[model samples]
Target: MRLAWRGPTMLVTDVRGELGRGVTSTGLWFRETRYLRTMRLLVNGRAPHLCALGGQDARTLDLVYVHPELEQFGGGGSGLARSEESLASDGLPHRSIDVRVSHAVQLDGLESRYVVANRSRRVARLVIDVALDCDWADIGDTIGDREAPVRIWARAVCDGSSLELRSTHPQLRYVTHVEAPGASAHQSGVRWTLELAPRDEVVLPLRVRAIDFEDALTGEGIAAREDALARWRASHVVVDTTGHGVEPLVIAAALEDLASLPLLEGRPREWLAPQAGLPIYPALFGRDALTTGWQASCVDGGAMLDAALARLGRLQCTRDDPRIDAQPGRIPQQVRRGPRARLGDGAFAVSYADVASPLMYVISLAQLFALRGDEALIRPHLDTARRILDWAHEQAQGGFLHYHTRSSDGPEHQGWKDSGGAMVHADGSSARSPIAACEIQGYWFAAQELLALVLWMLGRRGDARALWDSARDLKRRFHRAFWMEDESFYGLGIDREGRLLRSVTSNVGHCIASGIVAQPVIERVVERMFAPDLWSGWGFRTLSSAHPAYEPLSYHCGSVWSVESTTIALGLRRFGLDRRALQLADATLALASLYPGFRVPECVGGYAKDEMPHPGAYPRADLIQAWNVSAIPGLLHAMMGFFNVAPLDLLTIDPILPTCLDRVRVKGLRVGRGVIDLDVWRDRDGRSHFDVTRREGTLHVVRQPPPESISVGIAGRVRALVEGLLPS
Candidate 1:
C-alpha cells in the first residue's frame, strides 16, 4: 500500500522506507536543519536566540554572524562564522512567565497549575527547564588569582486572596523589600490568591530574566573573596515540566548520543566514480561507504523515484494562453504566469521569463518521463508537452527562437541564470535583445527531441518523425549560424542582426551536451573545456581561465556552477567521451567536498584549489539548493549508463563503475514493466558487470549491447532473449 506521487520537481512519499515515511539517518536529520525557515519555531519565536556551547572553540562559535537582511536561503549571516552581536539580535519575540503563589511553602502537599494558549496557527509544544549555576567561577581569573565569593538572598509575602511570592532558598538574604497587599504582609512566607480577567483565554508564559538579590557583605567591606561573595551569590535554576512531545528535543537527544560514540568509517559518494567531476553514487541506496552516515534505506529507490516523479508532474504546466476562449489541450504552456503588471490595455499579463520557465519544466518533465517510461504519467502530460513544442516553434524567426509576444518583458536574459548581469556580447559587452542565447536553444532542441521520442513511443510515428525533422532542421541551422570559425567554438549568442557574440564559455559546452552540435563540434568543445587553462582542480569556470574577462570570483564570469558543470559532464558522455566524462564527475565530487560543510552550494568560486586552497563562497548561495542536490543523483545515472526504451517495459543498465567503487547495489528500481534489483560491481580486471533481477512485473531484457560504447554485463537466462532483439 506504499504510494508515492511525483511532482514536477518534488517527491512526496507515503511509503515506509524513505525520508518522511519510515527511514532515518543522521545525514537526513541535517536536511531539516539546513534551511532556516523550515523550522517554524526558529523564525517566529519571542526573544529568539541561537545557542551553541558544546564542542568547538569559542572562536569557532564566534564565526557565526547574521546579515541585516534575509537572503534567498533564509539565512542572514555575514561570513561563515558566528558573532555575539549577531547572536544577540538573532531571533523573534518571546513569551513572558510569572509565578503566582497563595502561600509560602511550609506544607508539602501544595498544588500549582499553569494555563497556556497558542496565539499562532502553527503548532508548537512548550518546553520549560530551569538551571542553577551555583558555582560561578571564571577559569581565567581563578587560574591566576584567589577564588571568587558569592551569596544569595530574597523575600516573599502572600495574601489569602492575592498572589504571593517567596524565597525558595534559606540562604537568600533580602536586599530590598516591597510592601505586600494585606496588613498581614511581612513574613518569611505568606499566603495569597490571584484573580484573572479572561477566564478562558489567559495562558502561562515562560520567562527567563535576570533578578536582583541581596549581597552578603561584612561591615569591613574588604576587597577579598568574602567581599566578592558579599556582592554575588548563587544563580538559581528553574526547571519546567512542560517540554513534552517535541520531536526536536527527542531528535537532538538522539544526535547527542550518536555524537558521543566514536566516529564511524565510511566511503565518500565519489567512490563509485565521477560524473562531470562529481561523485556517482547510486540513486536510492548509495555506496555503503558513502551512505553509511546518510539515510539511504528509507524507501525503495523505485518508490522514491515514483514519488518525486509524481510531485514534479503535478507542478508540470502545459498549454500556453490561446487568443480567446480557446480549447484546453495537453501541450506544455507556451507562456505561464509570471510577475504580472497592468498593461496599457488595462489588464495584467504574464512576463516572458515566466513563460519560458514552463518550457524548461516541460522539457525536464518529458525527459524524466521518457526515462521512467510510465505510460500513465506520460498519457496525462504528453499531448500538452507536444503542443508546447508546436507553440514555441511559431515564435521562431531568423534561424532562432525569439521571445513571443507573451514575452512583453522582452528577452532580458530568460534562462535559469536570469540575473541582469548574465548576458554578454562577443567583445565582453552586454548584448541587445530580440536574441536567443545558446543554452535556451539547446533546451528547445532537447524539448523537441523529447516530445518526438514520446510521440514515437506512443505509436505516433509520423508525428514523431515530423518533430524530429524539425529538431534536425534547427540543429543544422544552429550549427551553421552559431559556429565561430576562428575560435573553433560556438558563439554564446546571436541576435536578429545576424551578428555573432562568440565567447568560449560554459554555455558553448552546454550546446555540445544537448546533442545539438554535430560530432565535430562536440569534440572541439570537450577538448577546450578540459584544458588546464580553463579547468580548475574543482570545476570548469563559467568563463575559461584564458579569457581576457575571466575573473575567478565572478558569479557568471568565472565561478563554477553545479548545474552548468553537470550539463557539461552529460555532454561529454553524449559525445562518447566516457573516460573524460568520468573524470569531470569525479572532480566535481571533490569540489563539492571543498564546501566547508559537506552540504551542497549553488555555485563555488572558480579559483583553483591551489589559488584559493578552499572553496570560495558565492555570495548569497542558497544553502539547501535543489538543483545542486539533484545533480548528484543525475550524475550517478549518467555514469551508471541507465536509460529506458520508452513505451516498451524495458530498462538497459550498462554500468561503467570506476575501479574505486568496489560494488554498488540498487533495490526497488522501477522500470516501465516492473521493479528490479540492480547490482553492479567492478571486477579486478577493471571491467564492470551488472546483474538485474526482476522482482515484479514482466521484463524482456535485450542482451545486445546498445549502439553506444558503454560496458554492461547481463545475468540470467533472460539476458540472451533480450540480446537477440533489434533496435538496441
Candidate 2:
C-alpha cells in the first residue's frame, strides 16, 4: 500500500517498486479537510482530466496564489515567499505547469499488463523530462526552514512502449520559472513514447538524488530560495523504493477510483452580480435580494464550523516558543502584528505582542475538543495546553490576565484589538501599562467553563467541579469589575486600578460569548447591544456611533466584522435569543451580499439607518479572508437551528429559516452516524417541515423533536435521546 500525507501547502507523491512486479491500481486518500478543495494528482494516473480528480477546482485553490509579499518565517528573509528563486520571481519569469497524469504500468515476465487506465476521450502522451537550462536547485539549509532532502537516480522501461524522459540539472526550486536549460541531459536512448488508448494503461520508471547540504547564501535571495527548495524536497522523499513496478499501476488505479466517486454537488446558479464596483464589500451587496442568497446556501452550518475548528486545529502551534515558555498551551492572541512587529513563525504562538492568552487558547481548544468528542486528537498538545492554563491561573491580576510575556521579544498588550490607542481611560484617554482588556477577561471565564466541560467529558469528576468553581469566581469578578451601572452596558476595558473603560461596543458580546453571564445580566447586555444606540440599520457596529471616538471605517472602533457578529449570534443563541440571532444572521447576510463575493469583508463601515441607505465599504479590506467567510455559514447554522441529536443515532432538525426562504435542500450531508440527504422547506402556511433520509447507515428514525428555540438543561441528555433512536 502507498502512504500519503496532505499538508496545507503541498501534496507529495513517492513512487516505489522495481521494473517488474504484480500490477496494482492506485488509490487516493485524504482527511476531507474543507479548505483544500481539490486533489492535484502528479505522476502517472489513470484519469486524464482534472474534473475526475476530486477536491477544489483550480479557481477556488486559495493557497496556490499566495500573497506576494515575502514575510520572514524563521529569521532574516526566511518567510513564506522568502527564497532565492522566489526573489527572482519578484519581477522575473514564472511558470505554471498543468500536469495531466494519464496512466502507468509494470512489466511482469513480458505480459504487459495495465496499471493506470487512461480515462480521457483521446489517447495521451506525456513528455516527462528534467531540463538543465532552466533555473532549478535542490533546496537545502536556510533560515525558517524544516525538513531534509534525499538523493538517488533510477530509470523505468516498459518492454513494448516508447516513453522518453531526461533530468539534466538535478537541482530543484519551489518556484518554477521559464528559462533556457543551461545543459541538456546526455541520454543514450532515443525519445520514448507510450501510446495510451482511451482507458488504456502505461508504466514509467522513477529516480531521485536526495542528499544533505550545508547552508549557503550565494545571493541576496539565495538563502531564502534554498530554504523553500529544501522544504519541498523534504516532503517528497521516497522512503522505500524497492517494490517492483507492479505498485505503480495499483496507485494509478486508486487515483482513478477517487476520480470516479460521485460527489455531492451544490445546485449551480449565478450567485455573484455586477454592482457599482466601487469597492470589494459594497460590490458584493449591490446584487439581488440578500435574504434569498442566504436561504439558498444555508445547509450544514454546524459542519462548516466543525470543519473550521478542525482546520484551525491543524494550524495549531505544534512547535514551542521561548516567549511564552511559562505558559505554553495558550494560543496567540493575534496571528499578525501591527507595523514592525515580528510575527511568530510557528503555527501557534503563545503570546500576542508580549501578553499571554492562555485562557483564550484553552477555552477554544476545550470547546472544540468537547464538540468533536475526540480526546486523542488533542492529546498531543495536552501538555502544553495544561501548562498554559496553569500559568494563566497564577497570572490572574485583579480578575484579568495582564503583565505577562506574549512574544519572543517581550511582553506587550494582549487583547483582541491591542492597537496603540485602543486601551483608553474612562475619560476617553489612553491607559497606562498592565491594562486588562475586557475581552481577555471574557475569554478567561469562557476558557474555565469550557475546560470544566472537557474535564467532565474525560470523566474527571473532581477536576471538572474544581474548574467550574474557578469559572464561577471569574464570572463574579468580571461582573463586579466590568459592569457599568449607569450605562447598563459592560465596559470595554479596565485599567490596573479596575476602572471601567466604558464603551458601548460589541466587546460586551465577548462577555456573553463566554457563557458565564447570569440570566439577568444577559438580558441587560443583550438589550444594550441590540438597542438603537449600539445597533445600526445594517448590523451591530464594533463601537456605537454615539461614542466620541466612533469612526465608521475604524478597524476596532465602529466597523462591522462578520466573524464578531457570528460569534455574538452564537452567544445569543445559547442565551435563548434565537430570534435576535436569526435577525443578526439576516442582517449579516444582507451586508455580505453587498460585497463582491458571497464571502464577507474583514470589516465594513457601520453606517446608520439614515446616514446611508447601505453600509459603506472599508477602504482596505481583504477579499478572501478565511474567518470572515467561515462566519457566514456559521451564522446560518445558528439561524437554521441545526444540531446533532448525538448518542441517539438520529438527527433532529428544527428549521428556524426566515419566512423569506421557501425551500432549502442539503444533499449528501455527512452527520453523526452516516450520510443523510436533508430537505427543509417552509410551506405557504408558514409551517416548517424537515425530511431526512439515510444514505449510508442503518435507518434510525427518532420522532422526538429538538428544542425549537433553546436547549436549557439539555447538555449530555440530548446525546442519549439521539442514540436511543438509532437502529440497535
Q: Highest lDDT, which number?
A: 2
Candidate 1 global lDDT: 0.42
Candidate 2 per-residue C-alpha lDDT over 137-214 given as tens digits, one digit per residue, 9 for 90 to 100: 111110012221222222322222231222232432111111112212222221223455655654432211111122
lDDT of 1 by residue, 291-375 (tens): 1111111112222223332332343334444331112222112211111111121112222232344355455555545445676
User: lDDT for every model?
Assistant: 0.42, 0.43
Q: For model 2, what is the alpha-carbon lDDT of residue 307?
A: 26
TM-score of each: 0.55, 0.56
Q: How many residue pairs clash (N, CA or C atoms closer than 3 angstroms) in each of the candidate models, in the order given?
A: 84, 70
Worst window of 10 by summed lDDT in candidate 1: 28-37
Q: Which ten residues in a row have the lowest lDDT in candidate 2?
A: 105-114
TM-score of 2: 0.56
